[model samples]
Target: MSASAAGPDWGIFEGRTLSLLHPASMLGMAALSVSTALLGFQWRRQRTIGGEINELKAQLPNLNGAKTVSEALAAAQSAEMVDTSYV
Candidate 1:
């Protein structure tokens, strides 16, 4: 029998003849859609975080690696020495 003549019904597998309807299939589809939305949200958040990091890096001073290391070492050397008598 044709689908329309039977009755008006809204279902995933209403008109399809070869389709097999299972409760688990509906759950699986729901899970797939939820996961897809979550993944898209996560991707967008990560991209925003990455852009902010890049912007901060650009705004900060670009120090030479060797010069910064030497400055740190000099500062450390000028600081008071820690006593190891207790150890």
Candidate 2:
């Protein structure tokens, strides 16, 4: 098929000129604006999430070692046995 018969070619920044009111230029400007806004939003969200993760890390107690399930159960039982008056 001929180039004209294919379809309307939507080239990025095509037919741009000094004037800012061109259709193609307006479309390009709009696209850039949308992408910049989206990127800024994503950056702020990630920064907020990073701050929250740091706060959570600071609130958590230090871990000594990993314990088996049975060992954890025994510890819980010992503690419970000593504090049966509260139950």
Candidate 3:
């Protein structure tokens, strides 16, 4: 059969679909996907860092001074400030 006589072949794209064709929409979708991926990575990193921090805190010798969570946070903040200032 001649090429012109044959009908257009849609079989190639049968199992696939184009959800976004417009330039703006495609760019927006790409940006959203990248943002979501970065957010997921950051969340995972924060979770890992938080676990490490908790583990380290557990390993430290307990001071009988701070009983409340607020007091502990304040002490940690103060220690961080002094550490940073010395650096």
- Cα lDDT for residue 83, candidate 1: 70
Global lDDT for candidate 3?
A: 0.75
Pick the lDDT winner. 3
Which 10 successive residues of model 3 have the least lDDT summed?
12-21
Query: TM-scores for all candidates?
Result: 0.40, 0.42, 0.37
Sort every candidate by lDDT, greatest first: 3, 1, 2
Tens-place lDDT per residue, model 1, 1-87, is: 576647646554465632555656888999999999999999999879988998897996644443675776666676546677955
* Residue 41 error, candidate 1, Å: 2.2
Over 4 Å off in model 2, which ranges?
A: 1-21, 55-74, 77-87
Each prediction's RMSD over C-alphas, in Å, is: 8.9, 11.2, 12.0
Q: What clash pairs does model 2 have?
A: none
Model 2 TM-score? 0.42
The worst-scoring run of ten residues by lDDT in candidate 2 lies at 12-21
lDDT of each: 0.72, 0.70, 0.75
Worst 10 residues of 1 by lDDT: 12-21
User: With candidate 1 superimposed using the best TM-score fit, by how many Å does residue 4's alpha carbon deviate from the native?
Assistant: 15
> What's the count of clashing pairs in each model shown?
0, 0, 0
Tell me the spans in candidate 1 whose CA falls farther than 4 Å from its real position: 1-22, 54-70, 76-87
